[model samples]
Target: MSIKSFAARIFASHIRNKIDKWASNPHNTQQKVFEELINKAKDTRFGKDHEFSEIKSHSEFVKKVPVRDYEELKDYVDMMVEGQEDILWPGKPLYYAKTSGTTSGAKYIPLTKDSMPTHINAARNAILCYIADSGNSKFVDGKMIFLQGSPELDEKNGVKLGRLSGIVAHYVPGYLQKNRMPSWETNCIEDWEDKVDAIVDETLKEDMSVISGIPSWVQMYFERLIDKTGKKVGEIFPNFNLFIYGGVNYEPYRTKFESLIGRKVDSIELYPASEGFFAFQDRQDANGMLLQLDSGMFYEFIKVEDFYSENPERLILKEVEVGVNYVMIISTTAGLWAYNLGDTVQFTSTKPYRLIVSGRIKHFISAFGEHVIAKEVEQAMKEAVAESGAEISEFTVAPQINPKGEELPYHEWYIEFEQEPEDLDKFAELIDRSLQKQNSYYLDLIEGHILQRLKITKVPRNGFQDYMKSIGKLGGQNKLPRLSNDRKIADKLNEII
Candidate 1:
C-alpha cells in the first residue's frame, strides 16, 4: 500500500472503533447530544420564547416546543436573517445553506460553527468506514471527482449564502486537492449543462476513482462521458471502484448505472441536508444508513400515520421500532428545534438505529385516500423492471383526479424508459399489482372501482430531464420527486411529453 493508504487504514480503524462504541448505545449517545443542544440554545430568542430553560426532560421539551417546518418558524429565522444576534442560536450562523423551499421561495438553513464540522466529518467518516470494512484504500490515490454545485458564494447581511453542496466544496481537504478533478474555474460554471461539458472535458483522461454526487446528476455525468468517449465508464476510469451518493435512493437507478459502468462498483449512501448531516452507510453489506446519534443533533420521530394529529406522540431513539414509517423531527446544534424536515424514514435495524428514508411527509398521493408513498412506487418499479426486462431512466407519480370524459381518475405515472418493455401493457399491470401488494389503500381503490388501474404515460426519452431543465432545476443536488399529491408535476410532464 502507498503511504497515504497505509495511514488511511490506521485512521479508519480508529474511526470504526469510535463509531461502534456509540452505535452500541444509541440512546445514551443521543441523550447527551440532546442536552448539549438545549443548553447551548437556551439563551436565544426562540429558546426564551419556548421556555427552554424550564425544559428538563424530552417530554417537557416536546410540550414546550411544537414540531415546526420552516414556514411555521419563519419569524425567528427572518429576525436572524435581518442581522439580529442570538435569535435562533447563540450569536449568528456561520452560513445560510440556501435551498429551494416547498411553500416559501428560498430557505436559508443555518449552519453553525458547532454543527459545521459534523457535516464534514460525517462525509469523511463514511469513506473511512468503507476503507475499514473492505480494507481498500487504493482508490484514494486516484483522481476523485465530486460533481457538485459551484463553490462561488454570495453573502446576505453578514452571513455567507450558498447551496449546501457549494458550501461543502469550499471545505475540500488540502490533502485531496491534488487528487480532486475538474478545476475550480470549471466548477464555477453557473449553467449545469455547460458545467457537465466542462467536467467531462477535464476528467475524461484522468485516473478518476471516487465519484461522488447526487445519483441523478452523476447519471448525467456518466452519460456525457459515454457520449464523448463511446466507452463504458469502467473502461475510461479503470481504477474507479467507489461511487458515493446522497439525496436520492439509487435502487431504481442501479440497473441503468451498472449498464453505464459496464461493471459493478461499490457504493455508499449518505443522508445529508442543510440542517445537519443525519446518516451515512457505515457498512457496505448492511441494510441501511447508520443514524448519526452523536453528531450534535437530537432526533425524534412521529409515526407517519399520526403526524397530522393535533397532538402526536414524539418517540425518542429508545422508543422507535423497525418497519414503522416515521416522520423525522430534529433539534440540532444549528439552532433548529423540533424541526420537521418533512422527510419520513423507516428503521431497518433498531439495534443500531439504522434507517432508510422511505418518503416525504408532503410528497405523497392521496387524492382519493389511496395515500401511496414514494417507497411503494419505487419498489413496484424495481420489481416490474426485474420481471419485464425493462430499463427506466426516470419516473414520477401523481393523482389524476380530474380526467376528461367518463374515464375514472387514476394514478398517473410519467416514465422515461431507456429500453421499452415488449408487452408494455403487461409491464404496467405488473407495476400496479406490486403496488397493490404493498399498500392496501391503493388496492381498495382499484378493487372498489373508486379508481381504475394505474395508467402509464411513456414519457419520451429525456422527457423528465427536459421538464427539470425547463424549471431551471436540471442538476446540482436537485432530485425529481418520486410522487406528488397534486397534478402540478404531472401536468408539466405532459407538456414536455
Candidate 2:
C-alpha cells in the first residue's frame, strides 16, 4: 500500500477506537457534553444575559433560554457582525458561515475556533467510521474531489464570511491538500457554472478516489463530465469508490447517480448544517446517522407534532424516543443558546441515537390542513419515478391556494427532468396516488373535495438553476424548498418556466 493510504488506515483505526469508546455509553457522555458547553460559554455576553451561571440543569437551561430561531437571535448576531467582541462566544469568532435566508437576505452564523475544529473533526470521523466499519482504506490512496462553494471569502468588520463548504475547504489539512483537486484559484470562481467548468478542467484527468458534495450539484458535475469525456464516472475515475453527501435526500437521485457512475460506490450521509456539524452515517448496517454527541454542542428535541402547540415539551437526549419527528435545538460552543436550526429529524435508534432528517419546519404544505413534508414528497416522487421509469433532475412543490372563483385549491409541482416519462398524466397520477397513500390528511382533503388533485408542470431544463441564479443563490448549500405553504416559490418558479 502507498504511504498515504497506510497512514490514513492507521488514523481511521485510531478514530474507530475513539468512536467505539464514545458510543459505548452515549447517555452519560451526552449529558456531560451539555454541562461542558454551558460551562464553557457561561462568561460570554449571551451567557451572562441568559443567566447561564445560575442554570445548572437541562430543565433550568431550557427555562432560562427559550428556543429561538435566527430572527430572534439576529440582534446579538448583528452585534457580533459589527465588530463586537465577546457578544456571543469568548473573544471573537474566526469566521462567519453565510447561509441563504427566507426573510433576511443572508444569515451570518458564527464559526468560532472551538466550533470550526468540531466541523472538521466530525467530517474526518465520518470517513474514519466508514473505514472502520467496512475495512476499506483504498479511497485515501488517490485524490478526493470535494464539489464545494467558492473558497474566496469577503471580510466584514474583521470577520471573514463565506459559505460553510468554502470555509471548510480553506482549512483542509495540509497532508490531504496534496490529494485534493481543483486549485484554490479555481475554487474561488464566484459563478457556479464558471467554477464547475474550472473544476472539470482541473480534476478530469486526476486520479480521483472520493468525491463529496450535495447530491444535486454532484449529479450536475457528473452530467458535465459525461458530456466532456464521453465516459461514465467510473471510467474517468477508476478508483472512485466513496461518495459523501448531505443537504438533501439521496433517494430520488440515487437511480440517476448510479447510472452516471456505472456502478454502486460506498455512500455516507452527513447532517452538517451552517449552524454546526450534527451527525454522520457511521455504520453500514444502520438506517440513520449517528448523532455527534461528543461534539461541542448540546442538543434538544421538540416533537414536530407538538412544535406548533403553545406549550411544546423540550426533550433532552435521554427523553427522545425512536420514530418521532423532532425539531432540533442546540446550545453550541459558537455561542448559540437554545437555537432552532429549523430542520426536523426522526430518530431511528435511541440506544446510540441515530437519526434521519425528516424535513424543514418551514418547508411544508399545510395550507388546507393537509400537512405534507419534504420526506413524504420525496418518497412520492421516488415511487412515481420508479413506476413511470422516468428520471427526475429536480422538483419543488407549492400550494395553489385561493383561486379567483370557485376553483378548488391544489398542490402544484414544478419538475425538471433528465429523462421525461412517456406518459405525463400517468406519472402525475402515480405521484398523486403515492401521496394519498402516505399522508392521511391529504387523502381526507381529496375525499372531502377541499383540495383538487396535484398539478404537474414540466419545467424547462435548468429552470430551477436559472431561478436560483437569478436570485444569486444558485449554488453552495442553497436548495429549492420542496414544499411551500403558499405560492411564493411556486409563482417564482412559474415565472422562470
Candidate 3:
C-alpha cells in the first residue's frame, strides 16, 4: 500500500475503534449527549423558559418541551436572528444555515461551535470508515469535487448566513483544501448551469477521485461532462470510485447513473440537514446508515401511524423497534430542543441504532385515507424499473382527487424516462402492485375500487428540470417531493403531459 493509504488505514482503525466503543452502548451514549446538552443550555433563555434546570429525565424533558417544527420554533429563532444571545444555545450561533421553507420563505438553523464539528466529522468519518472497510484509500491522493452551494455569506446580526452546503464548503478541512475542486471563483457563479460548465472546464483533464453532491445536480454535471468530452464519466475520471450523496434516495437513480458513468461506483449515503448531521452509511454491506447515537444529539421517535394521534408517545433510542416508520425528534447541541425534523425514518437495526430516512411527515398522500409515503413510491419505482427494464430520470406522485369524466380518482405519476418501458400501462401496474405489497392501506384502496391502480404520465425529456428552472430552483439541495396529497405538482405537470 502507498504511504498515504497506510496512514489512512491507521487513522481509520482509530476512528472505527472510537465509533464501536460508543456505538456498542447506544442508549448510554445518547443519554450522555442528552445530559451534556441539558447542562450546556440550562442557563440559556430557552432553557430557563422551558424549566430545563428542573428537568432530570427524558420524561421530564418531554413534559417541559413540546416537539416543534420550524414554524413553531421560529419565535426563539427570530430572537436569535435579531441578535439575542442565549435565546437558543448559550451564546450567539457561529453561523445560520439558511434553508428554504414551504410557508416561511427561509429558515435560519443555528450552527454553533459545539454542533459544527459533528457535521464536518460525520462526513469525514463516512469516508474514513469506507476506506477502513474496503482497504482502499488511493482516492485521498487525487482531486475531489463537492458540488454544493457557493461559499458566499450573507450576515444577519453578526451571524454568517448561507445554505448548509455552502457553510460546509467553508469548513472543508485544511488537508483537503488542495484536493478540492471547481476553484473558488467557479463555485461562486450564481447560475448553476454556468457553474457546472466551468466545473467541467476546470476538472476535465485533472484527476478526480471523489465526487459528492445531490444526485440530481450531480447527474446534470455528469451529462454535461459526457456531452463536452464525448466520454463516460468513468472514462473522464478513471480514478473516481467514491460518490458521497445525500438529499435524495440514490437507488432510483442508480441505473441511470451507471449508464451515465458506464460503471458502478461505491457510494455513501448521508442523513444530514441544516439542523445537524444525523447519520451516515458505515459499511458497504449494511442495509442502512448507522444513527449517530454518539454524536452530540439525542433522538426520540414517534411512530408515523401514531404521529397524528393526540399526545403521541415519544420513544428514545433504546425504546425504538426496527422496521417501524417513525418521525424523528431531537434535542441537540445546536440548542434545538425537542425539534421535530419533519423527516420520517425507519430503524433497520437497533443493536447499534441504524436507520433510513423513510419520508417526510408532511409529504404523504392520504387523499383517500391511504397514507402513501415517499419511501413506498420510491421503492415501488425502483421495483418497476428493475422489473420493466426501464430507466427514469425523475418522477413524482400526487393524488388525482377529481376526474373530468366519471373515472375513478387515482394516483398520477409524472415520469421522465431515459428508456421507456415496452408497455407503459403495464409498467404503471408494476409500480402499483409494488406499492400495494408495501402499504396495506394502498392495497385496500385499490382492491375496493376506491382508487384506480395508477396512471403514468410520461413527461417530455427534461420536464422536471424545466419545472425546477421555471421555479428558479434548478439546483443546490433543491429536490421536488416524491409524493404529495394535493394536486399542486400534478396540475403543473399536466401542462406538459
RMSD of each: 0.9, 1.6, 1.0
> Which pairs of residues clash in candidate 1, taking residues 3 or more apart in a chain or in different chains?
none
> lDDT for every model?
0.92, 0.89, 0.91
Candidate 1: what lDDT?
Answer: 0.92
Alpha-carbon deviation at 125 in model 1, angstroms: 0.5
- Model 2 C-alpha RMSD vs. true structure (Å) is 1.6
Candidate 1 has its poorest 10 consecutive residues by lDDT at: 488-497
lDDT by residue (427-495, candidate 1, tens digit) is 999999999999999999899999999889999977888998999899888889999999889888878
TM-score of each: 0.99, 0.96, 0.99
Output the worst ten-in-a-row residue range by lDDT, candidate 2: 473-482
Better of 1 and 3 by lDDT: 1
lDDT of 2 by residue, 1-497 (tens): 77876787788889988887877788788788888887888888898998989988988987889899999999999999999998889999999999877687689999999899999999999998898889888888789988888888899999899989999997798888888888889888888888888888898979999999988888878988999999999999999999999999998898889889999998999999878999999999999999988888888899988988987999988888887878999988888888999999989997678999999998899998888999899999999989888988899998888766988998989999889999998898899999999999999999999998998988998888888898887776777778888887778887887
Model 2 residue 417 lDDT score? 89
> What is the clash count for each candidate, in the order shown?
0, 0, 0
Residues 353-402, model 3: lDDT tens digits: 78899999999999999989999999999999999999999999988888
